[model samples]
Target: MSAKTIVVGNFKGGVGKTKVAVMASWELAHEMNKKVLLIDMDPQANATTLIARSAGITEIESSIFESFENSDLSKSVLNVKENLDLIPAAVSFKNLPKFLYGKFSDDIDQVSYLKTLLEPLKKNYDYIFIDVPPTISDYSDNAMMAADYVLIILQAQELSLEGAETYISYLQFMIDEYNAYIQVAGVLPVLLRPGGRVDHATVERAKELFGEDNVFENYIKHLERLKAWDITGITYKDHHDNRAHQIFIEVVQEMLDKIEHFEGGEVNGE
Candidate 1:
């Protein structure tokens, strides 16, 4: 099987992007029998902490930020759970702009450094999911550029739409300027207050703007399954409540289907 990387990102915050990233990685690793690498790029380290706790491991503090200035990979990486590994986040990462752009002087293309670092590890995992922060930076750009495809998570709100639009425009710029090889993984809709006024309309607008082919077939309804599973030390797919578990399973399979479509195009014509 071929390796794939999916980036979960949005330009605006507080839209469950991190949650989606964590759940997607967990589902892939625990449910689908796939080896997964979860890269916690956000300084918050929510995904890192969540997975670490689930596995009864220590919450991670140090992360790929250190990898930017340091040569040692061991210091930045942690095996947070069975069949899954993580590169946690650090508070120091918040101040990485000058360090990466100014201090790393002569020859390093810091943008692709993370990619180079992961090249040797690609064969070890079937999927790598990168959780990006709301702000734009080399860290987010590097991950997106390195990825086979990028996934943008959006909520059914005007603010979320603004963020998604900004992100997609930036991604289009990157693809045109530097990463002509990259393809968008897809846009996933996480509807807030599932049946609320304007939410259904918001979903329709999203499909129209992103194109029908780029939207997920399964729209994530507002549900308590996530928080419940997070607090209980169980996975969504492992919950006794089969309804919620099945919805997420359908999402995972839909993502795989979209990715496979891209791959098929490459083999057939590209």
Candidate 2:
């Protein structure tokens, strides 16, 4: 079966986009026993760092940049867990735009190159999650063109909400301009606090803007364990770690349910 590619993104930074991408992939692979591939398209490579730390790898010999240069992403695939693989990103990936411009004269070809490269590898995994930078750039364009769906992260803030709106508008632009076949899977809220006033109001505004049905019910709560994982890598040595991981499990279940609904031919708002 071909993998369903999903890009986790936001137009604003510091919104936990990587957290959702990494944790969701981890949950899908470790908890649900699905074969998952996470492509770190962001040049910052935070996803690559975290996953590498989790896998106990201190050095990366090759990265997605090498794969892009070779036009073979499968060669860069690194096993991160039992069912999870990764195409690590490097600082060198910042040259992707120059690389694309050198290769293709057509704008569409430049943007959709990742789609062509990913087609051969799609059949090997159940799901492929991409983590992109928080901006409108070649990285995000390639990811959106390659993806089947986008999971927009809505952090509880005015700017974050605006970023999500901008993200949807850009997605529509991609659809209209390049005819990219991708859908908005859902808007997932990552709250600053469990029941903070700003958090609650931001979510309400998101529901009003994106429609209630398109917003996910399983919002991510503020968890300190998540921060710890960034430094120490993902852990399940104690109840706190499991509790933190459980949050993503619930989120993934809802995400999969939404995906199934979309696959069943039900429109998101209807």
Q: Judged by TM-score, which candidate is best?
A: 2
Model 2 lDDT on a 0 to 1 scale: 0.90
Root-mean-square deviation (CA) per prediction: 3.5, 3.1
The best candidate by lDDT is 2
**Model 1 TM-score, all chains together:** 0.85
TM-score of each model, paired residue for residue = 0.85, 0.94
lDDT, residue 160, candidate 2: 43
lDDT of 1 by residue, 26-96 (tens): 77777787888888877777777777777787655567778767755556777866777888776777766
Local distance difference test, per candidate? Answer: 0.73, 0.90
Q: What tens-digit string does per-residue lDDT give for candidate 2 at 73-156? A: 888999877999999999999999999999999999999989999999998899999999999999999999999999988886
User: Which regions in candidate 1 have their CA more than 4 angstroms from the true location?
Assistant: 59-62, 72-75, 103-108, 157-160, 194-198, 229-232, 235-242, 265-270
Q: Residue 211's C-alpha lDDT in candidate 2?
A: 84
